[model samples]
Target: MQETIDLAAGPQHPNQFALLRQRRFAPFFWTQFAGAANDNLFKFAFTVMVTYQLSVGWLPPKMAGLVIGALFILPFLLFSATSGQLTDKWDKTRMFRFVKNLEIGIMLLAAWGFYAANVPVLLGCTFLMGLHSTLFGPVKFAYLPQVLRSSELTGGNGMVEMGTFVAILLGNVAGGLLVAVPEIGHLQVAIACVALAVVGRVVAQFIPSAPATDPGLVVNWNPVTETWRNLRLAHGNLVVFRSLLGISWMWFFGAVFLSQFPSFAKEVLHGDEQVASLLLVVFSIGIGTGSLLCEVLSRRHVEIGLVPLGAIGMSVFAIDLYFASRGLPPADGLHLLAFVSQPAHWRVIADLALLSLFAGLYSVPMYALIQMRSQPTHRARIIAANNILNALFMIASSVIAGALLGAGASIPQIFLCVGIANAVVAGYIFLLVPEYLLRFVAWMVSHIVYRFKVRGDEHIPVEGAAILACNHVSFVDAVLLMAASPRPIVFLMDHRIFRVPVLGWLFRLAKAIPIAPRAEDPVAYEAAFAAAAKVLQDGNLLGIFPEGGITRDGTLQPFKGGIMKILETAPVPVVPMALTNLWGSYFSRVEQGGAMVRPFRRGVFNRVGLNVGAAMTVAETTPEALRARVDTLLRART
Candidate 1:
């Protein structure tokens, strides 16, 4: 059972931000924040030292950043599988403390290396810090859904993502500042690293105990076999596995831009290092802003609908960025001020900001969805799978981008190629999992075409098999219903309705059931019910028009026995719903004609609503009772 979030909390204390004051969230946030900041602080300080302050015989200045990055990423590839298993077998709070303690130890060693100017020791410490992050990664996501209710997942994830990016930004800024502090720079870097690690440990002490989900599971020590097993386990649920890939692809996409930032700023924008830092600042702030906005945009749920929206924005801005890059005025040694003084550069900044902002939106919902949907026992392992994939994808992005550059592709051309590729990739993913595209369509129509609102939406189950019985009002009724649900709803709609333009294509994409009257076509009717039964058995949501068909007379129609037929096939709970104010919509049978007759009868953003009633037990559900429930809901505010 999940804890109830304070949904009625006032604006001043929005439940998402209010989490900052609560024990369950605040401590974990700070602990993770400190760890991320410290990791970046140490790495950046070390990179700066190797690049500018001193040059070792083996490590050239140009290769310093790449070497440190490769070393840090190596641990994720090697140990994520093992870390995930430990996270599941041990108490999460204990794991948190252990990781924090390990951080402290690593930072202490790092302190000595910094003070002594020991490049080798610092490099080793960098890998150790990466190890610390790897150990902590699986537990961090797994711990959240353990404490937060499903309703709070998106907000919780949004806050954490925003915090993580901000922390990384601050750490990099601090690292650069500390390591440049004249003669005392190295000493300050060492002191700060140790202090931050200690602070992280202190915060870790306050995280509430999250009991092991799979206490008796035997640990798999082999990275190769264990990694393969974890990936296979995650694949048991196709959506979850595909989502893991989606997130990894996002990392790949983001890394391309991030890796090119320095070159992009210096070569293309004709700016110096300060200008490069400015680009970083813009990108970081954009992502943080988008992450924070997910909670509001999703209305505090794990809404994958936003994923498509985010993907579209990412591609659009990335493509625009290519064009924006080509038009910048040529100049030499232009500092931050000089770059900003030109109007053309503002487009570059805007394009970069919006592109990164969409990346944030793209990722947070998937992370929350993965956590919410995975088996609690193996959630950590699945997350570990995600981490491993992320590492691989980032490396691939670097290799591919490097190859493109080596093959004579300019930075702008590369951007254009990535932007186009993103669209094709996103389309393929949506096709594989139609639910994503379904949700995107529903969300777009409900949020844009109509001023859609929902009442009693919580009665809908987030998982498992359940029958949704809504009074059909228009051709797009299923689309609106999909908007109100977090899960994919396989709507059992009337066969004739599938002939409606555009909507017909969408329903086919959604794989909605098209049932004929048993008397009219017994075989088709039987097949529809059989398909619905399969959906229930597969633990998916099934939707039906309990009134048999859309009302031609703008009033509640007599109840049909279709709902009972579905329940008889699978004894899942039936949720009664009503769509209000759709009677006179353009899609409805109004003005003595069906759809397209009064196209402007209801303008864009027209007020409409879907009112959901309580779920009825199989024993309590009947055609008449379901009708009465839906009728009451329809009459509530009409």
Candidate 2:
């Protein structure tokens, strides 16, 4: 029998770019890229044809655009529930091949539609293409978590997003240019679509098998009833459901921005196709760059902090974009070069780029969080519900945009309104779950307030139940640990700390267990121990300050028996860690008069270190032993 080595155990820190070199990730990435490119290619080609070429069957160009939009979105509304069920019930690899083959068939039909200039056939192909995407959506997302380790999820999703936007850019440019050719324009589009479809299928054949999440899941056929059931399943998990909302809101925001590109280019910039293409390229590149950066900024963890950061940037840049485009001059036939020749246009481009970069930062982590949090069995269905919500949000954006435009709002004004609305919606969601805000604060503090260096991080297990016994040096020790560790830790904190003003809310949001001294409050202490035990029993990491409070003298305090009591109940392995050089920091009491002070007492970017010792078996662990191990780690670092 071949021994299966755990990838998580093999490397403590794996770079995001490494996934691109692995078989499990590379092929699927290309397949998705090809598929996205083909979808946009056909859709863009048809839209261009409608706008410029043959007048079809009494429908105005604007009405035709709307009709095509409806056709594309109709399948998501009707077929996503069934598709989600299918993904859960069947092997994802096999289903992936089936979907790719379906795409080939759909593209063949699209080819003929393009060749014949047949409006009805093209519209039918659009609907079928949407159905193909609808079927692929759930599998595409849910498949990542199964194949990649927990740490790699963020990077994998980042690559996927980066590949997707790059593909979209290529497809739009190729489609628009190809369909504009004099005689063979339609044929050219047809051939490109068929060729890309074939390439996508070839890539799909190389994807390894992903076992069925729920092989016995009975496929639900009714769209309405199943859709309701799927929504209910999603609603059952508040965090997952809220993540779905965040993801959907991003789509709504994106659709509004993207849908305005052509019109905004023509009316505001007085530019032609080349200028529109330029805008598309800049936005796509920005998103791709930001997506790739998410893994770097997160340090290979799914940092939810980026979501709020992204949301804030999106609104800020979008508002700036509105202002930048205001009062622009008319340059009737301005091409890309001429537009770039002018200095004022640079601001518009900068706004779009920054807006897109933040959008990427906002989205990649949320997808990772959803995949990480959702139940494995019903993950696909939850993703399906997410897709449904995304479609609905996109549709709602269109409706709202139309209403605004009909009411005499220019495209830039609409952009401004969406930006303001984004702030309101994001604020509301953050209020509903302060975890997002708390995470942002932790991330910022670790990255901005203190420069944290970690050693022996490999000693910490990537999954399953474990107890982390550490000596807390400052108030922000938990935050530092959270930023360093790959998995979330349930910290056992003093109840008094939980009563402090702003920090209290943050600790509560992190779901920290609040313990009291046994002599002071026997009931609270017992409850805190019970909660700690439950956290470990659920196979999560529980962190406790074995000294029971922040160190006031920059030295390890004698260990308390609470650690032993919790270990006696849960009996999980204990990993001892130590924090060094945090004693005189702003949050520490080592400042003048032993009072906590802020604003760079240690100057900017003060060095702090966390050394994680090896895990100790429960049979050998005790208060004295664990404290000794942590002191040894601290001494070695010092």
Candidate 3:
């Protein structure tokens, strides 16, 4: 049982409005926006220049593609190891400003290259830009978990992704359009790149400086040794490692689709350079829409349940893209308007949109998982591992693409291959780490079982340790507590329940602490008390049912002395709660003889209530006194 509040103040809700107004996150957001804009700005300009301006004969498409891929790959390989170390050792905001300054220099070089029509210099700038991103990557990820609440992670990441992809799409379009302008030509593209870089720097200046959390840390700059070392640490956690792989695989799937656009547009769609541009637009827009939708769909919290759904969509839509482009007349420079008029092209458009939407849904949750799960001190190192895997997976994608394309596979077929591969990879990872799946099941069950409404939830302190005491009303009291509590809980449950069939497996998986009543098993009782105290001392939430067992008569039971013992030992704040109308549920063993309703026989769809009281300090609690207090709280609600 839980309580709910209607926070339906719409998109411009006061809380969201206050969040956006914050100095710390707002400027950081725009700095990323500018960085993404400039990255695609230069890439789009360089691609056009190489094909139209530099090529006197037929351009070696595969070779050009490989060079472009290398530019993106080199930074992650060469700099991210050092970058992660720097992020951990220094102030992230200050480091971000320095990275932005480096971007300014890179853009100036790109601007000159465009003006001189110097392809080599432009390529050099691309490599430099990638290096900047490499350095920024760890800091970008590690900074958010430090600044935002656990509940805010999903929405924050979604907003970042949305801003990034939207910027990429606009930059790609703007880059091409600027270069093509008759009065400015290629030089205008460079000019715009420099301007965006400057804008990025301006925003970076406004970003609130963050002091280093680990200032006494040693810095290691060796890419090969350190990168491998980082990956080793990240892989130590089986679930975290698998989540990283799932994320990397998504990038591989995305990169394959993005890299083949020019050829796909020219050969398959029979469209011009602008058509390739439009493909970029559609993909970016789809990703942006999907990214923003994550916050709304998840109700502003991280929900890994959506990951499976996204994987399913990615495979299905990608396969559709294969069939969508089949039997099309080859393209050879038809303009944008003409391309749109073609009825068959609409399938390609729809496939791209769905593919991107699913991709957005897929990637956001994995990021949140890493943030929530990774050890804080080693967070940057773990994120560094993510960057390394992303690079490797992306590089692998290029190799796979090259091999398949060389084997005479079509671009659409490659899309299908990557998409199907994503499904297989995602499924395997989730199967190995069933927590993601189990959480989804638990979340769904609680949501459907009753209309949970939380009130005065703000009284549940945000940080440090505390003890939560409520009546034992049902078998799933712990599960309901987990859903209602914002933080992860170290729950004390009966040893008997801990051995019960399928649910026993769940409790064990959750790492729940088991105890037997003193009368039943003295040793287990002692162990439970010790475990509960240790958890509170270590700064984790501890939930205990003061009632000790489920109510047999649908009336409040005497408060157990166990809670008082643990509280006195740990000296943490106590939060009292009352559960109403759950006595007839299947979990409650009611009416064995002369009790109220047969609680276990009350099927599904039973309405229940949970009312949370304000916190009580350790000094205010006594076994007798707290029992009276809880009795009064429950009586009022009843």
Q: What lDDT score belongs to each candidate, Candidate 1 first?
A: 0.90, 0.89, 0.78
TM-score of each: 0.97, 0.95, 0.84
Per-residue lDDT tens digits for candidate 2, residues 193-241, read 9999999999888787888889999887999999999999999988789
Question: What lDDT is obtained when candidate 3 is compared to the true structure?
Answer: 0.78
lDDT agreement of model 2 with the native? 0.89
**Lowest lDDT block of 10, candidate 3:** 1-10
Residues 417-437, candidate 3: write the lDDT tens digits: 887787788778777987666
Best by lDDT: 1
- Candidate 1 regions exceeding 4 Å error are 1-13
Which candidate should be chosen as best, given TM-score against the real structure?
Answer: 1
Show where candidate 2 strays beyond 4 Å: 1-14
Report the lDDT tens digits of candidate 1 across residue range 559-580.
8887777788799999999999
Worst 10 residues of 2 by lDDT: 1-10
| lDDT score for residue 26 of model 3 | 80
